[model samples]
Target: MFPPKLATATLFPLTLGLIAHFTIAQATLFIDSEHLPQAKQYDYIVVGAGPGGSVVASRLSQDPNINVLLLEAGPSDEGLLDIQVPYLAFDLEPNTVYDWNYTTTSQPGLGGRNILYPRGRVLGGSTSINLMVWTRSSRDDFDRYAMVSGDDGWSWNAIEPYYRKIEHVVPPVDHHNTTDEIDIGIHGTRGPVNITTANAPYPIDPHVNATSQELGNQYPYNRDMNSGNPLGIGWTQGTYGNGVRSSASSSYIHPFTSRPNLDVLVNATVTRVLRTGHDVETGLPIFSGVEVAQSKTSSVFAINAIKEVILSAGAINTPQLLLLSGIGSSSPLAALGINQTVDLPAVGQRLVDHLVVANQFAMAAPEDDLFEAIRRNETLFNELLVEWERNKQGVMTNGPANHIGWLRVPEDEQGWKEGEDPSSGPTSPHYEFLFAPGFASTVAGTPVPPTGYFMTIFTVLVSPSSSGSVTLASSSPFDPPIIDPAFLNTTFDTQVMRAAIRSAARFVSAHAWDGFVTGQAASFADVNLNSDEQVDAWVRSQASTIWHPTGTASMGRCEDKDSVVDPDLRVRGTKGLRVVDASVLPFIPAAHPQAVVYAFAERAADLIKLGRHLC
Candidate 1:
């Protein structure tokens, strides 16, 4: 097993360094109670300092007159070291007080396994804990969002500018410049967030390259995957600057925290939204302020909002916060002895996340193995850290899994038939492949190596047909909520996942890999090959999520009773209230959520600013 603290020490310093450099972005925020004016009102109050919250805060505060308040339950990320390196995220662990440390209630299909889920508890939230890959979905994904929200502006064309507005791409240097082989028109240059491809000393496994090329050659219209159309396999673009993570706090919020109008409260846990009087006669209620309790303190205080309340608290927290504030299923709240303020039945419904079926195989040789270096000598490990800290170049700066692909399983295959998008454009697929250079010996820890040096080809099922729910585990705000992801609950989801695993393995076995693979010292040949049942079993044993959870407070058309937010992201039936986060996505985005969340927040900030002008 890998040393536990090895990952933590390597990643922590970079995390803190980024935070100290970026806390100024939240300068407009009022962190102390003494700063609040009598019955004070602000132009906007954004909760949760994650991707959406930070972006909204950064963008809305651009106007010198507008006052923005950003509240986060976690303490400032300052001085936290492990979060800085891109590759050491796994070492931070569920034990770190900065993690929410959520666990699934029970995934019925995975034999009731309760997997550990970690959400960032620091100022930047999960973005600080993420892999930092800047991946975008196919254009159709946004078009579908526009269709669901009844808004024409959500299409790919409508939001591309926002994506470009938040990114600053570091050009490829040296032999790593595959700019000739891939498309670059889709990337941005002068944005708040810095993004770039790295040329870490790690060599691309010849087998991996040949296998991916073989698949592309077999498929038609196999364009570069990072292009607007993500059909073929390619290297992943990452969100990093000088080899360190570029979280929203580090990129967008950090630069502007010195403003006097902004106020940020860390370690404040909001119990519920305070209501003045229940419009009992009309069954409608008005929210006045939010009740917050400082972590490890009994002093609960209420902070009132003057103008509008925004919930950018992420998919899980946004909905849960709503329900705790008596804005959820009436019956459930009543049972918990809480009076219902707003009967929004869908508050905690529609939990969606990506599911993956990973296939692991033994490498033919261990010469280039990551484990060989780290395990063999402490100096090699220290050198890796120095390389990242001083030069911002090395394995620590790049993700162990640096390649990604989008694939369409044969429609005739079992589960692939059920979740087919009738509206899909050419080259889009319901399946994705995330290739990594290591395997896991246990689910509770970092990537493993004793399986004799292996690679994991994880197939993710996006747009899963199955739906799940998030509910109160108990009446208390401190109690963790019940999360039922319902993985593999649908026959179609399982079928497509199985096929994806087979395809990934088949590519490795093909003659195209004969020259690259060589079969010399391959470790996993003992396993059964060319059998669907065997592939299915192995998939279940190794699969893991890419950690993209969305749709808890999904947006929808005005008439849809289940909708939590309007297309503009306002919480229905409440004034001066809105939710600008991943929870607003009606469906999961086709790619990583960090980029899209940034785009959405940019648009939300514009809407908030325009609305303020009208007032």
Candidate 2:
């Protein structure tokens, strides 16, 4: 060990050097709030520079008169290799620079364990960290939302234009230059977010396609799942443009940075909304701006909004923000010595997420192993990384998992004997499947296999009867919120999950994988396949989140008292405040929520511009 004086001498200049690097290189993104005026005002203040907030802020800033302030709690996405590469999302899932890294409040449904939930803390939010799977929910799902929210504007037909407006459709996965099989009219050509096939073909692609056919009539290959109905097997469409990850920041925010009216601040955490006064009799607080700081120890300053303050801080943080600002239940805030401004009881209630149970099989085809080709060999891996860095091509261009299937619970298992016409799609589906060609240990964070190649199958329960909440752990915004996504609380959810696991087992054992899969591994070997009791036990042990959480700050009709927001995404009792993220969704959609969240924000920009409930 070095002497005390020598240690200090060795570290002092290095500390200053690191500080100088950030001060000079990232001066624009890292705003020196301490030096700015106490309360610099803008026309609109967008809290959370995620998918939703970025879209709204970008569109609102299009008008030169409307000054928009976009704030993110993390650093910029620039020069972050993991953010640029689509396949590196798993590396940022937990305890990473990009994720907020929140955990559940001891879930009683999952053996009373706290599970880690990753929400993007970076400039693009979860969009930069997500697998970039681009798909929408069922049309009936949105129409049902329209009915529940007491507004027809949310109907699928009404919202379809916004869906097109936010998407720039490209070619398929296997073919780069041609759009032969792609449905042209269903997608847009000039949207910011690029929507295309997960494009790079894998060694196991043909096997999954062949297996889909071998499964007989149950799982047919779908022409295009994005064309309203999603009840079939297909190659996943990802949010990718060329070979790079098409995140919300790269698509919406960075492209429009030249606009003089927009100001984006990274590493700025929002503490609470600044309320100026209250509505006379209603007691609803009139919003002015948001108070922000770099961290708990930093000095908090206000960024005043001239027209509105939008919270797109995602499902977990959005409700936590409302609670800290005295907009939640009276009992909880009063106990914390916080005065209640708007007594909305549902601020942190009715939280939902897509919980999944995964299974892994030992790949018989050792020659086509991703673990061997990418991770095991250093020289080849470094060369691939170099290729990706130089031209943004190679294996790094695709996500870890690609083959996604939306399927109904089998008729025999669910006690529904009749098969409905899928042309218009079933009203909804209970399960979705994601197939991957990699070691389960590497992708799903499980114990590594002793040797050889492996593949994973995840069965996700899309619609669950049970729900959870995100309550304030303490009054301090520095403390993380209580996220309890009470998974498998209901018998139906538990039963459906068991069926989903069984379906995955059957899919892996099918003739399509006869030469590819040698044997099943992990929990599958430990549990008795024939017994329902054993399967339920296995599900409780292996179930994890797909990271799609919503409905904490839900919108509903006035009669729906549990609703925190109104028909037009406004906080029920407050003026000049609105929620335009996944939290505002009344129920969890039947598909991944990123695409839906983008479309919601696109329409929200128009509604906020009109200053009405409907656009």
Candidate 3:
């Protein structure tokens, strides 16, 4: 076990150094509303300290002459053990104070279920609470963005460097050499966010790898999925180092808090983007100002940005803020008594999210079921927690999944509408599978069995055909927006999910798992796997989100009527305001979106710095 003192000793100097630096630099790191100067104007005002805002604010403030202010609606991420621990990620959502705790409207496709949607509300945003999976998706995913926006900057060739710029590969907690596990040449050694593989090996790791080899080409063994070709079973990479979560706040904001030009304000919510004036030639409204308040009833504060106001409030809140500011469809704003600021009707449309369904199977080797053992035995769980706190090595250092697989539906099997292929290209995945060595339930309120050991295969529809929206529930900024991800709404999405479930079954049916493998768990025992109707019904009943939401404020050509933002990520029919987050993705990448968001923000910072010259 690592000595507890060693961890403290390592952090103490860093803390002290930050304090000393702040004292010498005389720079304010955090500011409350009462201390904020009313007359001062900032060069840039970034709303929401998520991956997008954090990178943008940090990169922009690199220029010593630029002053940046970042506003977050939630509390600080420091000292939150739940946010820092990778294994504790599951405890931070679904009505936690650190989460937005929003729920989707009832959906017909989900058997009239209202899914619990959790978005991070802290300094690091969702990166602090997410499962920590780091996937950049496929190369074609970026090329499609370039093709749709008519800008080569978003292509894989142009954006690949940003991925290297955003990641810093670190050793896992166990300190084992990862030469064969991942491709070090493809990752960055000197970057802000730290990425690593699972620390201690799980008992099922060998079985999974063996199955990959036994199952032939369809389940090919991928040495590193993050190498722009994510098409097979490979080790899962995460944004964590030394058993500690490396969130956006920790990577981008916390390290540079002592910079004199940057100021981060927690518990300060920007209610609306205040329009300052109209452009002399284009007649576009200038949204260089923002209305902020500590609470819904607190005193409203008006702040101006001399350069721009960047919105990084995730997919849900970005559109909500725009709609509240009268920048959405004019018809709805008129009914809500809000004067029209922009006639763009696509602000809250095109919301896309990955839907997950868990297929659990009983495991014959109960002794090797680490996750089930921990859940059943409190003493074992406490001992493991102590082990992690002491030496940062144990099950606590990893998330639920140890490996992930991205696969495309066979070309002949694709059941999409004619000429309506949703995937970016041939390399893009139609669905994904996360292999968890324990019962992994995406749906809330599902009870774990008391005695039996189990493993789960999480089937995720990456290229979803069904789209939804984020619209105003009320005119008040305090009200939560009505979100409708519309999971499994289309026959195409349902067919893809059914295929994923069948593929997962075939994966575990390999000769390598003859002894250890058991039949399906009780939850899915009755479902006829051979029947498409029964399989689709089971999927609809069990489907929930992986929490990778995007495309609410999608980027496209300026003349595209359905696009909310242009290729530069500027809001249509508006000036001096832009969006830099997952919300700007026209389509959700065929993997987790955190890594993509980081790269996007890195590129966005360069574009914003280049200004009109690039636009």
Question: What CA RMSD would you report for each candidate?
Answer: 3.8, 5.7, 4.5
RMSD value for candidate 3: 4.5
lDDT of 3: 0.86
Please give the distance, in angstroms, between residue 270's alpha carbon in candidate 3 and its true position after superposition: 1.3
In model 1, the runs with Cα more than 4 Å from the true position are: 1-41, 172-175, 219-226, 276-284, 412-427, 445-451, 515-530, 612-615
**Model 1: per-residue lDDT, tens digit, 380-432?**
77788788777766777775466676777664654444435532555457677
For each candidate in the order shown, give its overall lDDT on alpha carbons.
0.70, 0.79, 0.86
Best by TM-score, which number? 3
Give the number of the best model, judged by lDDT.
3
Q: How big is the positional error of residue 121 in model 2, measured in Å on the Cα after superposition?
A: 0.5
Candidate 1, residue 127: Cα displacement in angstroms equals 0.8
TM, every model: 0.89, 0.92, 0.94
* Tens digit of per-residue lDDT, candidate 2, span 1-615: 000010122324434545565456554454666644345568899999898999999999999989888989988876566677676665666777788988887777777767778899999999999888887788878888888888888888988888889899866434564343346688888999988876677777778788778885877787667777777788888898677788899999988877768888888999998788777877767886898989889888777787889999999999999999999899989998878888899998999999877677778777676744565566666666667666767777787666888888765677422442111236567888888776553123455555767777778888777899898878899999988999888777877888888878887777888878877765566777789899888777777788899999998986677898888888887878999899999888888899999989998899888878541
Q: Per TM-score, what order, best first? A: 3, 2, 1
**Winner on lDDT (2 vs 3):** 3
